[model samples]
Target: MKLFNIVSKTTLTLSLILFSQNVSQTHVYAGVENASPPAVGKTAKDFSLSNLNGKQIKLSGELKKGPVVLLVLRGYPGYQCPLCTRQVGQFITSAAKLKSANATVVMVYPGTAKDLNTRASEFTRNIKLPANFQFLLDPDYIFTNAYGLRWDAKNETAYPSTFVIGTDGKVKFAKISKTHGNRSNVKEVLKALSSSS
Candidate 1:
């Protein structure tokens, strides 16, 4: 009887451990498996995410002003993503042209809620964003999941993505990179903006 009791308890403990691991794994791949990125010609979903200052920036509101350039960045996956930095710098350099195109650049940094604001601040510490640019934070990947742009892998926050939305709220161009380096360039976005118009 004593040996049988010990075996039963051991089996129960192992089962609990396995169950917890499965739950965690499910969370890691959550949002990406069932959804695809928004396709061109489709109406992009409107979402409201706050910048570091906690002011909400709504997609529909931006669209009302003019065309919108939406960028999904990998937010604080252990550290600031270097590729995101370079891509944003490219956009900053071409901000004047983007403005001439009457496009509002909305960059989304998605990450866990804890320390997300701090991480976002650090990410933008060295850069001077243009007047037309808005850096928004997606705490707990709310926007990423909503857009189906979540990378859903180890040490990754989001799949780098860019979308050019026309004033009509239709997506004119959409690029989602599964790899880290193939980000949308400023020229490509500019072309998309021009074509969208």
Candidate 2:
């Protein structure tokens, strides 16, 4: 009887352990399988990326003045993505509101190094960025990988994500879309910025 009781308890313990492991894995994959944005209170790592004009810009430089909005975009996915184009247009319409809140908006375009300049320039030509806005190129997705936003598999090029960094260089707000269509609109970001202010 004693041996039977011990075996039963051991079996129950193992079952519980397996169940717990499965639950945790499900949460990580389902909740954040595709893209998980940086959480608030995390210090955003600084990076330098080149613009279409071949000018290098650093994240620290933008945050030195005030808050900054960093946007990660999908670049040259065989052709220009319509959803990305729409998102950029939404931001363009709200450029004045973003500037009034003293935030410098920087968009990062990630693609292969080959023909990167042509793709980045083509992207900018389609969007009318504000004076305070800048677009940078992330060839080979180095910056995206560092930020944990690289898709790296399947049809995805890069995960769409946004970060609002405060003057202290910490992430104030972050939103990442898991699917292609579920993005934080410009008004949503503007509301977050206003609330933070």
Instruction: Score every model by TM-score.
Output: 0.83, 0.79
Model 1 stretches with alpha carbons more than 4 Å out: 1-33
Q: Taking the tens digit of each residue's C-alpha lDDT, what string does model 2 give over 1-197?
A: 99999999999999999999999967644533343456888888888998877889999998887788988888777888788888888888888989998988889989989888887788778566788798999988777776888877776788888888888888888888776788878777787788777
lDDT of 1 at 123: 99
User: What is the model-wide C-alpha lDDT for candidate 1?
Assistant: 0.91
Backbone clash pairs for candidate 2 read none
Name the runs in model 2 displaced over 4 angstroms: 1-37
Q: For residues 25-143, write the lDDT of model 1, one tens digit per residue.
A: 78865764566678999989888889888899999999988999999999899989999999999999999999999999999999899889899999999999899999999999877
* lDDT agreement with native, every candidate: 0.91, 0.83
What is the Å distance of residue 15 in model 2 from its true position?
Answer: 54
- The alpha-carbon lDDT assigned to residue 23 of candidate 2 equals 96
